[model samples]
Target: MQSAQCSGRTLRFGFFEVDLRASELRKHGIRIKVQEQPFHILTLLLERSGDIVTREELRQKLWPAHTFVDFDRSLNKAMTKLRAALADSPESPRYIETLHRRGYRFLAPITPIREDPAESHANFNHAALERAAASLENDQSQDHPKTGFLLSHPRPPATWTWFSLLLGTSTVLVCLTALFLLRVNHSIALGSSFGNLNPRRSVAVLGFRNLSGDSQEAWLSTALSDWLTTELSAGEQLRTIPSESVARMKIELSLPNVDSLGAASLSRIRKNLGTDLVVVGSYAILGEQSHGQIRLDLQLQDTQSGETVDAISETGTESRLFDLVSRAGEHLRDKLGIRAVTREEAAALAVALPSNTEAARLYSEGLAKLRVFDALAAHDLLLKSVAKESNYALSHAALATAWGQLGYDENAKAEAKKAFDLSANLSRAERLLVEGRYRETAREWGKAIEIYRALSEFFPD
Candidate 1:
């Protein structure tokens, strides 16, 4: 462990300085905006500089037993914030180095300043006086008797005093002007590089849980979640992660079908799927089973902060489930401050979706299966869906994916062609997805990549 006696309480590294007593970090003598947690972490690392600081050690020091926090996630976020403040990188570290599953170590060499804080100001003044005296001697000739005057006398003559004041004032002006330009340039670079650090928030709509207690209606959970995912993607300002991506992540992470999650699970989703917000929901059939009412409950969660941003509950009948989806999605977008759907856009979406509820259910379940690589199950469900509604372009496209994965090349090609033939009325994003699926099934890898790249560019998070 590093000792204050070995290196004074004030430590300097690169162009930055850390004052342990003040609990402050400064770059070029200017303080940086660092959060309390990150600042504390930095102090701990500095105290153990050049040694590995185990994550367990940090948790004990930083959080109390009753903290009730996600230690791993909190530590990772604090490290990220600390790295940002230092403009450091884990990949090519200049100050802090990560040790994979072990811990982190500080890499920079530290220099200690004077132990006596009281003498610091006097030391600075003495240096400045020396420089000023040297300047006077250089300006005057050796024969000038006053060359050693500044060194001999504690105070300078009035004429020399005026000269020193003028020099000091000019230096201060130059320094201030330089600092101003540096700040302006830094602001401009940040704007151009990160667009004020606000990117389009990426959202993932998880499969809703079935609370109706009827196993037959399990498909409705996937269907409603898929519907909301599509509707949310209609907005240009929100980047909705594809249902396939969410399904794959669910299977990979072994996440349960639920309306809510703990902070650790949410953090995993955010990191693995690159999602900012997650929409977890549940649906139930109420009152009567024959022509029962349906209730949809959705909660928008900020994955990073693990906070509920908004909750929406919509009630409708089975026949108007699609309408309920539209209403919930609209409310969700509104809560996010995204633009409302236009009439033309809404019309296109209506035309693209299958009007038959049976077809929608089969298609949703089949798509979910396909995303999880359950090729045979997806193939059977998708075939039944297309039989129910032959012209459902998305169903055909998804069928193509299922068929391709099942190694039925001929059937995949046929479904791909059928999807393209029926895609004329599809939304722009839907059309791109169909075309990319078609390219993939046809073995046109390059063309498929180009189409997917276009999709990502259009919806970039």
Candidate 2:
């Protein structure tokens, strides 16, 4: 029904005027074959014409109800398709502009036109069917003898045949209704499950309390916390809180050290962390060998109900910290019936990044400093981290964070964009911070921190 007039013969934009309804791309009057999802993405860009579309917004629009899709892969593929179709290189994009950490924006103009005659006829038929029942209502109100006779009855049918027909029709309708209801119920159940699924799993890993009487392993608690944060972060499913925040909370609560905390302090720590899951345990160094044991106590408590859905503990040795943490992660996944990333997949992700043990250690140190609001120190450490491993996505993300904290918006954005371009696994919070959206940035950071905390408990050294 909607139409517009075009004064010119051609609707041109760098040799392309995509047909939105048909989901077709035409370059200089030559058709370009674009896949379904990419075509939808192009259509979305065309509709937005002159505004920035955030990646989050695009994800929600394109994959509104599906969570299984690899959004990063699909989105990048679509963008590649678009660039190829438009002959626009990423280095010097003309039609579509990539806004780095933000979303995409259409750099061209789009003009609407009236539907052609054949298209108009097709639309009319579709509209006519949609209005058919309303038209019949008006027709029924009119004085028409044929309509009245037809409505009255069908006569002279065989009684047995009529009965059989009626029975068969009723049975079919009942079956259809039952099937529809069953599907509706299934959808409702799945909807409930989806509602319970939080992409950001929050947990607080309390620093290990040093129970050993000797002061020789004084730094053990801090080292354990840092190690756990790093090892646990290896799994993308968890959002571990930075150790600095936990340390700050401990100081604020006037708790001398993690080991000095009692049951009350543990509860207070959980509240301060504001996490769904709380991890509490103690560690002791045995003899000169520095042998230590850790027990990971996990509790998923409801904020409203104050009840725990999951509560379990796992014991492990310092030598097998990674294995212990992986086991705890499995337990948590089992408790929630959540899907997990396989070890091979996790290793692949780790290898794909530009980070080694030293770079990771520096990055972790920088993150801890950043958590305590030490922007200068964090920046210095993060710079060293990236210098050590230039392609490290997490380090780039951390550098972006430090830059943003120091008011270097452009530099921060550029670094963040590079990080995401290299690997989408950079903590979500780091990505948001680079985008200049503080609230969302904090939210994502919190989520990442919580996941780290949970992992730390399971993998304590």
Candidate 3:
């Protein structure tokens, strides 16, 4: 239990306070209602927030030890009423959350106030005696002070009584005052943290521009963009937009000169895609050899701040495209503190298809064309890629997405299922894509669109 003061009240977390002298529940400064028998049950639970307060224990506290009551029903009713009054639910609760077969736990943190330690001690000593007097008063023994003292202690003189009462009242007030100050401090801290949060701490990867003069290199660009999107989305913490949506947005707001799409364009892209950061990159092949060197120029810019946060270029052999993507992803992870899927784990989960194989290469090229909104061309190339290598899962998945986009639901569903079966670690977004195609086949356009939006977040470039 923590102690603090807020608004001149002593608000207590555990153990309900019953200031019988003032007829209030003053844990700190705020007054909690304690109407009737509910107060007895509340007090017991408060004293032991995380511990079980058995029905028998509550009955003993509320009624006499010898008294017999229908413990189960009455106790349950009281707890339900208490929870209702406190605005707490057994399911998805905040304050008095339930613990199933066990008992309840007071989840709220408690703060108590300590004002004038010396005075508090002195008042405590006197308050005990005053309470005794009050108990006697309730028992119709107020007049016979000496008679009450035979069982306990006698009341003092009138002047002494008034002085003790005043001291007790002052102590309660002090507790309340301390509680108020503490609450205000806590509120301020929460408000400050919330206010200072930067919404521009998010980024999206746009589909990479294919600068390979040869049409065969197109797959490499799509493969790089798709892999990067997957790596970024794996971070989970970073708010990455989906590649599919970015691809659509890129075509919708086609800026001819890629370099001309600066801060203003980035802002428009972010607004259109509902993202904070935008990433744009281009890839190029520099030789005619099968294992040519590929260069990637990548940039990350904050939409709201209109400033670049990261800009770097990586060059690697085209044969090691996946490896380059992995390295690039690691770089971004280090720069932006983005979490990444481990190489060993990612490799183990990856669909085991020959990357450098002709079929895989063709599929990768088709995917690239699809990224740039050339769906028909992409479809044709992807079909060729699959024909050469029917076992390539990625090509099959890409083909499925293309088919779905072009309204070939039956074919898309079959391909997506094959992808799901072949790929060990299909992302949530990818799974949604498969489901979306399945839903589309059933003519559920609304649900299919919803799934597509979700898939876009993971694939958004």
> Which prediction has more favorable lDDT, 1 or 2?
1
177-278, model 1: which lDDT tens digit per residue?
A: 999999999999877855645577889998888897888888887888778887887856787887767876875566888988888999999988999999
Q: Name the 10 consecutive residues with the lowest summed lDDT in model 2.
A: 1-10
Q: What is the lDDT of residue 428 in candidate 1?
A: 85
My TM-score estimates for the predictions, one after another, are: 0.57, 0.39, 0.48
All models: lDDT?
0.81, 0.61, 0.64
Candidate 1 global CA lDDT score: 0.81
Q: Could you say which candidate leads in TM-score?
A: 1
Separately for all candidates shown, the number of backbone clashes (residues 3 or more apart, or on different chains) is 0, 13, 36
Once fitted onto the true fold, the runs of candidate 2 whose alpha carbons sit more than 4 angstroms away are: 1-202, 210-263, 266-273, 282-324, 331-355, 407-411, 425-461
lDDT of 3 by residue, 1-461 (tens): 22113322444454444443354663334565556676656555655655666655677677786677776445555665565345344434555655433455667655544444578888998999999877768665654556654354576899999999999999999999999999999879866746444343556677567776566565665567667777666635566666667766764565432422577887788788888777677888877663678888887777777888788788887666667777787788788865667665476425443455576677766765566534556678888887887766667778886665444567877877676565545555556665665566556799888888776544443
